[model samples]
Target: MTVRTTDTPVRVMIVDDHEVVRRGIVTVIDASPALTVVGEASTVDEARRRLPAVRPDVLVVDLQLPDGTGIDVMTRARELSPEQRMLVLTSFDDDAALRESRAVGAAGMLLKSARSRDIVAAIEKIAEGQTVWPSRPAEDEEELSATDQRIVELIGDGCTNREIADELGIAEKTVKNRITAILHSLGLQRRTQVAAREAARRRAGWK
Candidate 1:
């Protein structure tokens, strides 16, 4: 992809199993005046190898990889540079990954279906030391069952009910039921509230 920018581009590393997805993201990166694609990787191994060389300011990583989970890459990146900004891009918006990513120091998480502008905006925000999350919030962990927790994660990751159901291999109706229970238990008006709560908890280092 060609980079078209005059701003001090936020150097980025793209990690995903799909070549076309990576290229598309690269195209977005290249088109953004504030971002640049420094490197791309199809798996954890390649990411590990190329990361040190690229030493990008931000990493746009997919949660699922052929060889290993993106968390492996996150850990490696942390070891290399604790300050490196990591933004997750995934099809499964599992709440567990969202919490884990935050606990492990990811700056942001976005769904694969997020608009190109939204993706670039997230990259820029992360580079500027700000966190960006999906509009839907996660439910309180204490108030959710294992299944509910999974649903919340997906919601926080920006997945629709159908997407969440597909990811968890459950019925969409089940997801709806779990969400209803979660709201009642947590006394939260909207899912975004859960996201806000999680964000605050992460900031306070309240695992």
Candidate 2:
């Protein structure tokens, strides 16, 4: 939860690569009495350039873009205006992306799969400085989940995807999918890196 420091109409920016999608969001915001569309961007560079000038209270952004990502935009936006609340409005609902959003300090996240009304409501809530969505599970100590440890253990043991699958009694594809997810959770690029980090942790007496 948060509290707004300003009394102005909720100034909003929409950053989506799709023109139709941007226009549609603008239409919805324009209809709302408490909200106003201050600016719009279809690319990360454009959004980066325009975001500060507009000084929006809330930023509604898509995940993917031609030049960069909404996460990239928000990362820069946070540096410029840390007080501004950002709402992730994207088609992606995966845990990794959500975790990344939380890492970068987005106020909330909503999927494109959500209803138009629900999207608007999320925007309104964020604009009002209220957290509106469930955040990714992040603990103070970055407590790794049991599944994360299993993946790390297999990776550290130099187990291939098939090997991990056989050991865990799951399909190889499932192991591969979980590896991708584990990489995201750990903010790593490859499975080998997960293995390296997990080995270091074990060396430090972490089970």
Candidate 3:
């Protein structure tokens, strides 16, 4: 298990478009001894303006912002500070959004319906460099061949089919066929999902 090296509270920034929700989150964060709210924003524009200055240890963001999206904020945050940790706190349980968050390096995701304690714990875990995604059933887990695993890693590295093919010393058609098989094996429909899964695995320090 990962442990924090310091006793200081985890600094947090909230980006949600709802006033009531934001206030409630602020309350929950303030109630925690291990977490503190450094800033809050109700719009994407506001978040972008304040993010660099505040530089919170974790950013808890909602997906549907007035000006843009949580994805936009997370992407920009990554550009500004690659080490910035983020958590998605959204009402929408969207697979695409989740995959996008992982692709952009969010440490975790939580539904707005989650208990307050879960939210606090998620923030704490994210601050400690741990992932807190929703748990999948055992049946959803699947093992991949070594070649497929390498392809997943290449996809996570943003390699195109041709690039992966050349790097693996295989034909492009073979690469595509392998990716299709991988998608089916993983119960995923899109290449982005494969990439996102690989990214999350790496972030969690999985071999």
Index of the highest-TM-score prediction: 2
TM-score of 3: 0.67
Residues 1-207, candidate 3: write the lDDT tens digits: 334689999999999989999999999999999999999999989999999899999999998887767877987898898988999999977555555577677888999999999999999989898999877666644666677779899999999999999999976855765676577667898999988898899999998
For residues 93-151, could you state the per-residue lDDT of candidate 2 as single tens digits?
Answer: 75655656666778888887777788778888887778766554446234455665686
Query: What ordering of candidates by TM-score runs from best to worst?
Result: 2, 3, 1
Candidate 1 TM-score, C-alpha based: 0.66
What are the RMSD figures for all models against the true structure? 11.7, 8.0, 10.6
| lDDT per residue as tens, model 1, 85-191 | 89999887766566556655688899988899999898988888889876544444544457766666677677898998899986675465456556655667687
- Winning model by lDDT: 3
Candidate 1 backbone overlaps, count:
6
lDDT value, residue 64 of candidate 3:
87
Off by over 4 Å in 3: 1-4, 137-207
Distance from true position, residue 139, model 3, in Å?
Answer: 7.1
Collision pairs in model 2:
none
Clashes of 3: 0
